[model samples]
Target: MRIHTLDLRFQGIPGLIASYLVESGGEFALIETGPGSTLAALRSAIRAVDVDESAIKKVFVTHIHLDHAGAAGWWAQQGATVYCHPNAARHLIDSSKLIDSARLIYAEKMDSLWGDMLPAPAERLIVLQDNEGVPLGEVEINAWDTPGHARHHHAFVLGDVCFTGDVAGMRLEHSSYLSVTASPPQFDPVAYVQSVDRLMAAKFKTLYLTHFGAVSDVAAHLANYRQRITEVYERVAAGFREGISTEENRRRYAAAEHQAAMQAGVSEELWLKGESANVTSMCADGVRLYCEKQP
Candidate 1:
């Protein structure tokens, strides 16, 4: 199987988001659809490679985040099969709750941040069970229940590569620094760490992340990712103990992370882009929600 990454140019940033196109024996599958805002770019990219966008028979996403599977409905409208976790199948097929949830996060900027998300036809939706395998040409794509970034999240193990959505955290192409993506309502730090450990225990040659590109150093990247997620939660937890507002906690968390990135020698350019892709404001809500759920 040959895998190619297409830059969605999210929020006008080239490497902030990516969608993978996998082909085997003339059959093609699109892993992540990015957001509806980049549906046109995705089509143009596929066409530039001489493959018709409509020829993608199987469309799979690691999760239902706008940055991951936001454009699945658009592809389904084009005659493609949309596959996602059963927990999220209804949301994607209807998308009324999806849009409503986005309103909570993006507010008036929802449309600007992530264009329209039309419902995927109900007949085209396929729900994936954990550990179930679906044929992707010559390879069998296996799904793992990875519920850290979201309860409905799944990581696909295809041949030698693992298409880990937010379960593996964020890292852009230009730099090697790993950032957390603790988005609102469903972020679980304990589960996030365990999921990273699970990915490490699984035998995979490389990890293809939705936030950006692929990472060959699987062990090193995941170890650092687990440690960082813990640290970010501890930092946020301290703010909660102090009785600080969520907004104030987010401010402190972002500043601390920015300083740590500077000390670690991450470039200013990618740091800015990476943060925009997964900001502390969202992470703050995620941490707070998890903290409240804890004893």
Candidate 2:
């Protein structure tokens, strides 16, 4: 199986988001369609490899998040089967709720940020359960329920390579800084840790993150991600306990993340760009919600 990492050049920033094209025995499958705004970029990337967008008959998404599967409906509309976790299937079949929630957060910047989210046809939306495998030509793509960043998240596996969606967090290439992508409404720290444990137990040789690209250091990456999730969650919980406001917590988290990136040899410009791509404020909001729900 050959995996091609397609850089969507989201917001004209390289390494911010990626979509994967898997080729096996002349058959093609797509993982992560990025946002609708980058549809043209994705098409260009695919054509760069001499493969037509219509040749992709299968589309797998790690989750229903805009950056991951925003253009999935477009693929399905082109006659490709859209596969996702059962929890995420309904949302894709009817994206009204998802779009409304995102609109509330992004408001007027919605179109530029994520573009339009179209609902995938119900008949074309294939829901995969945990441990189920979908045949993609010679290789089979397996789906594992790896909820953490979102309740509907899944980590797709092919042989020893795992396409870890946001459940594995965000880590840019050449930078040792790994930030926990805790977004609101469904970011459960405990569940996230458990999902990491699940991934660790699988012992995959390589991990392909949708945020960026491949990670060959699977063991070290997962371990560090698990530890970071714990550290950030505890810090947010402590801040809430100390009566810190959500905005203050976000400021503190962003500052700490910037320092970590700097210590890891990331340039200030790149760090700022990454911060803009994956806003740390959402991380604070996610952790705060998790803390509030605790007994």
Candidate 3:
């Protein structure tokens, strides 16, 4: 089996987003669909690899986040079996609730950032279980529940490469700016740490992140994810407990993170682009939400 990394080149940002196309056993599978806005790029990328869209017999998603699965419904409509966590599988069947939840976070940028989310037919859904290997003739694709960024998150292990959705965080090329993709609602530091540890302990040494490309320094990356995410959460939690407004926390965390990234040698242009492209404020907001839930 061969895996080709497809750079969606979201919003003209070179390394901000990616999806993997795995060809094995005379079948094609997409690990992530990216947002609907990138579907044209994705189609083009697949074609460049000499693989037709109709050859994609299966689709695997790490989560239901619009960035990861916004075009999943479209893939399902292409006669491919769609596999996702049960919690997320239902939303693709009827994206009304999913769109509502996203509206709460994205607001007016809905159509611009992610585009329209269509509903997939229920028959195309295949809910996966933790540690379950997908039944793909000659290829072994195992999935495990990895909830940290989101309760419905999971990482797929295909041979030596593990598709670490958001659990792996964001690390752009040419810069050591490793930022966690801690979006709203469910961002548990504990779960995030555990998931990172699980990925490190797994047999797969190469991590294929949805945010970017392949990362082979497994130990260093997982360690950074554990330490830095905790630091961010702790900083934001203090503001949340001290009655800081959400807007204030966003500003504070974004500034602090910006300084840290520059100190770590990230260029100003990339830093600013990373902030907007990665939505750095949302990570702080996620930490604020976690702090709010605490008594």
Top-lDDT structure, candidate number: 2
TM-score of 3: 0.96
lDDT of 1 by residue, 32-84 (tens): 89888888888888888888876898899888888888888988888889888
Model 3: worst 10 consecutive residues (lDDT sum): 272-281
Best by TM-score: 2
Writing each residue's lDDT as its tens digit, candidate 3 over 8-65 gives: 9887677888999988778778999998989999999999999989988889989998
Stretches > 4 Å off in candidate 1: none
Score residue 147 of candidate 3 by CA lDDT.
94
* Count of steric clashes across candidates, in order: 0, 0, 0
What C-alpha lDDT, on a 0 to 100 scale, does residue 233 get in candidate 3? Answer: 87
lDDT score of residue 281 within candidate 3: 81
lDDT of each: 0.86, 0.90, 0.87
What is the per-residue lDDT of model 2 for residues 66-102, given as tens digits with 9 covering 90 to 100? 9999999998888999999989988888999999999
For each candidate, what TM-score against the reference? 0.96, 0.98, 0.96
Looking at candidate 2, the ten consecutive residues that score lowest on lDDT are 270-279
